[model samples]
Target: MRPTVLITGASTGLGLAIAKRLLETERYHLVLTARESSLERFAEAGLAPSEHVWLRPLDVTIPSEREEVIDEIEREGTGLDVLINNAGVSYRAVVEDVTEPHRLAQMDINFRSPMELARLALPGMRSRRRGRIINISSVGGMMAMPTMAVYSASKFALEGACEALWYEVRPWNIHVSLVEPGFINSDGFERVRWTELAHLALDRPSHPYHRHYHDMTDFIARVMHNARPTPESVARTVQRTIERRRPPLRVPGTPDAYLFDLMRRFLPRRLYHELLYRSLPHIRTWGPQAQPVMRMAPRAMR
Candidate 1:
């Protein structure tokens, strides 16, 4: 009997890439889920109905859907051997401009929903005495940035919970790991742009911290271009993490992710902040510069 693996956000970007990699292995039968619209992408990616794969529509933010996925897995009788919590959303606005609804939405998708799904999958995994839980987190989870407070907070919450879960589940031979990736050259930013918070607050020029938001956008775009963590690359890391006899607690999914992890571990808070700020010209404190939006909003953000 093939071990069953469930993957959230399996329609595109990292999720699609991971699905492809796992399917190639033929070692595990995958239960892949995404939004209803994205479910078709599985067929496009060659993950059609087969003994090796099962595709379903899942919006992780919904509680009923979470229960439904786990319950369906139980009906199969084999139980879940691996759970990949890959569905998450992110935006890029300063915390000052973040509405309460947006903050809760971010937490729900990135942090809470995964925890809830894990709660549903745990009983089967615990009864079987073996499982793998992998979360696709970000470097920002460890090192928060200026316009990334809300997104980072959600990831930080996930990392904290997973850290405790790692210790708690050791006795059951359940391995929990975080695959932290840096900025990737993927369409994920655009997919999440529907959120007002994800953009640099260029429209509201009167808003404080306008200059900081303006400058940081260019800085991150450049960083992503230089970074080597593509969706496919991260997928490779995820595959190896799952295949290992005793996987490490954390895996850096790209070179930049590895560097960020090192920086977070070795650099002082003041030094790290200084290095980051120096890269952006106008990203200082909320002083006089915040009163004006000097440059045009990037065409992408607009």
Candidate 2:
């Protein structure tokens, strides 16, 4: 029997790429879920629904919908061999500026939903004594950044949970792994929800960080343009993880991901902070402007 794999958020971006790569292997049956409209779009894009691939509508934040999907999987007798928790959303804003609702929304989709789905799928996997649970995390989970605090927090939560679960399920022959990718060129950026507070602040020049907001956004755009990895690369990482009998608990989705992880592990706290800050075009340029004021201060002040 072909291994059955279920991937959430499979209509576009990395999820879609993973589905395509896995289908090409012709080694596993795929169960893909997305919003209804995205399912239509996927079909229109030539990945039309078929027997080997099961397409279903899913709003991961909804418990009832998740239950329905799990029930269907059981009814079909396609006991899941792999569960890819790829469904996630981002909310970009400073920690202080992020509203309660936006923070909760990020946690709900990125952390809570995946955990719930994993819980539902574990029983079957335990019974079979073999399975894979791949959690799609981000480098932000390892190292948080400005304007990404809330988003990173959710991924961090996921990493911690998955890591603990890995130990607990090892005896059952169930493997849990985290796929951490750096910036990826995908529809994810377009889907990001900027907090209302951040938006309002950007509209007002008098706001303390108004200039910084535009500067950061522009700097991020440049970085993404120059370094963003392809979704296919991430998909390939996922495929490899599934094939390996004893894969590492954490895997980098791209070469740059490996570099970033190394830096985080080896660099000194102060030096790392300085290097990270200077890497931003806005911060580097702004530093020189502040030097003159510092030089002009009274000798006692200096």
Candidate 3:
């Protein structure tokens, strides 16, 4: 039997591109999951139903659904050879304005679900004596940003969990790798639905930080439009990571991701924080009114 690979968030973006690339190889059976809403888009994009690509409706944030998905995989009697945790979202919210519900949602989708999925998949992979877990993290995981505090925090947690799991599972011949992308073209931003508090923060009458919020949102909107790397680039990297005999514990994607990583390592903590604060218009000021969008804002780490 071919190796079975399960990829979360495969309905679009990097996950979808990876699925397409792997399908061309015909070396593995693929199981993919995304929200039910993505099916039409996937179909419209010309990905037909096939024995090679099995699509399942899953919102990984829900525990019962995750368990059911795993159970169905088990019942198929196909051993999972690789698990790619790529399902995540970033909410553009400041610390002060992020509501409890929104914060929980971000945490559930970006960090908690990945950990739970790994927890469920690891035992089976260990029993098999050979398996791989590739987590699709972001540069946001490595450093802090201005408006995406909650998102960054979640990714940070994910990075910690995966790094710790690497040592724990190495004895079982299960390779764990983290793929961190700087910015990829995805609906996570374009289709980002802000929470009520975020809306209030953006359009608040008494908002002390309105200008900062507006500037951050403007920068994010522009980045989403023009500054993203191709999903295919990320897909190729993920494929290479899986095929490598000695894949590193972490793989950084995007042009300057490695450079940024190095700088973070060598720079003084205060200096790094200062650079981040000064670079983002949102963090440099507090405001009572929405400010004009700045067109020359520098590209973020994403």
Candidate 4:
């Protein structure tokens, strides 16, 4: 029998791409879960019954809902062979601009829920003495970003939890892997923008930190508009991770990701922070006419 693979957050983006790729192989049965909102859309995507695509309506952030999903899966299948925790949320808010609830919500969805799901899956997997857990982390987790403070915190927490759990679970023959994609094609940023813009207080009196608030939000929007790594690329990396006999603890999905990691390691902390700040649009503002003048500066000075 083909091994059953359960993937959370499979409504779209990297999760959907991974499901699509995995289905083509004919070697694994797939169980995909997302909120009810995505069901009709996914059904319209034309996935056939023979594809072995089982859809479960689940909100991973809710403990009861997640437990129900686990129960349903157990009733319908033999046992889970792999679990991919891909569901996540992002927000374009600096630390001071964000609310306490928003930060906790991100942590709930991105870190805690995934950990809980993994906890639920362990008993069965340990009994079978085999399993694979692939965590879809981000470069944001490894490095800080001006606007994505809360999102980074959640992902960073997830990375730490997964890394430590990797050691504990290896004895049970379960392989745990983290995939950190630099910038993948997803609705994450758009959602962030919509929420931030909707919640922003336009008429409120400006404060010392208000300039940063707008710049950071706008920068996040521009980044979302300008560059996005293909979901297929991340899907391929995930496939490789699952199939490889010896996968590393972390697989960064982009050259930029690896480059930044190297830079963080080799550069002094102050120098790295300065360079990073200069590189990010939020921290470096230039007038429309300023670019041409700046471009003419000496190569080193520029």
Compared with the true structure, all predictions reach lDDT values of 0.82, 0.83, 0.79, 0.76
- Candidate 1 lDDT score at position 16: 88
Better of 1 and 3 by lDDT: 1
lDDT of 2 by residue, 22-80 (tens): 99998888899997667886776468677888889988988988988888887785788
Looking at model 1, which ten-residue stretch has the lowest summed lDDT?
191-200
- Candidate 3 structure lDDT: 0.79
lDDT of 1 by residue, 213-282 (tens): 7667666766676666689888999999998999988888878778888887899989988896675655
Q: Native-vs-model 2 lDDT?
A: 0.83
Please give, for residues 1-302, the per-residue lDDT of candidate 4 as tens digits.
88888888887888888988898898888988888777665676566545477888888987887888777767778788889999887765657667777777888999999999999988889988999999999889899986578889999999999999899989989999999988654455555531243244321223344445445555555564556578887898999999998688899876667888899889999999988878765444332222221111111110
C-alpha TM-score for every candidate: 0.91, 0.91, 0.89, 0.86
- Which of candidates 1 and 4 reaches a greater TM-score? 1
lDDT of 4 at 200: 46
Q: Stretches of candidate 3 above 4 Å error?
A: 282-302
The all-Cα superposition gives candidate 1 an RMSD in Å to the true structure of 2.4
Clashing pairs in 2: none
Tell me the tens digit of each residue's lDDT in model 3 across 212-234: 66777667666756755778888
Superposed model 4: Cα runs more than 4 Å off: 49-51, 185-187, 193-198, 201-210, 282-302
Cα distance off (Å), candidate 3, residue 229: 1.8
